[model samples]
Target: METNRQDFLKKFNEAFATSDVDFILTAVSDDILWTIAGDKVIQGKDQFASSLHEMASPEPMKLKIRHLITHGKEAAVEGTMTTPNGKTYSFCDIYTFNGFKDAQIKEMKSYVVEEH
Candidate 1:
């Protein structure tokens, strides 16, 4: 059986891959704080969906997950998102999940890094 965090991350990735805003919100807390690269911060599910739509608009040439690690209440993921324009953005994202109940994520804090 997968851990709650692992399950959440898997579902989150699936939602992202398909641009499913509703599914994303189901896994994310209502007050989740999502910080993207380049100083963009999104709060709440609505804002997350909007920001994600804008970010995902570039078209998925490819999105690859390089690594994922979890420690206590925190997790980090490294990945590359290649846009339709042929721009590859390598990123590392750190996340903190507050709690889990019924396998649902209660809160989260995300930090992002972009490759130079």
Candidate 2:
């Protein structure tokens, strides 16, 4: 029996494998809130889906998860991504998933930057 935190982290990684809006929708809550540094907060799953779609537009994005940490309903991920231009960016993201009972992600906040 995997904990909600573990499950969420696993599913999040799976999202990078394909642009499956359904998966994204299922993993997140109806009133999900998502944020990335310097970006406006995305208010719902619908909006999140639309935004993620653009990432896989010309080609699928690749993500490699380096580490994941979970403290109760909160979790964090450190990973590396390859941009469309072949630039690799290593990022560390901290996330909080509410509604542990539902095992659904109520909110997600991300902090990212170029690898240096």
Candidate 3:
């Protein structure tokens, strides 16, 4: 199915809610730039996939989307989640999408606040 920015956000969130690595990977560009806050930044699909693989297990992280907004080819998603280690984190991700109909993510900047 062809996806616009909103559709991309929905699919991405749904995949994330279930911690579906394969499905989530399908929504990212091969050269995607993923930034965690202003500190950690990585490029390339392999690097991102590798990190996700390390995180997901039989019981994966839980994510629940509270809000999502999109304009043009950009989107911002905000949510709360529980990590595998049982830590709670509230997050917001700003995304820029490729012009393709499937709206693969070209760049993502994340901001997260965790309960210590």
- With candidate 3 superimposed using the best TM-score fit, by how many Å does residue 58's alpha carbon deviate from the native? 2.6
Reference-based lDDT, residue 41, model 3: 85
Best by TM-score: 3
- Clashing residue pairs in candidate 3 are none
Best by lDDT: 3
Q: Which model, 2 or 3, shows the larger lDDT? A: 3
Better of 1 and 3 by lDDT: 3
- Residue 102, model 3: lDDT of 62
lDDT of 1 at 64: 81
Backbone clash total for model 1 is 0
Where does candidate 3 have its weakest 10-residue lDDT segment?
1-10
lDDT (CA) per prediction: 0.65, 0.73, 0.82
Tens digits of per-residue lDDT for model 2, 16-112: 5456667777878878888887867888878888877765535555788878888877888888877666777677667666645667778887777
Q: Write the per-residue lDDT of candidate 1 for residues 19-94, one digit (tens) a residue.
A: 6767776766677787655686788777876787775653434668877777776777777766566666676767
Evaluate model 1: give its TM-score: 0.72
Error of 3 at 28 (Å): 0.6
- TM-score: model 3 vs. ground truth: 0.84
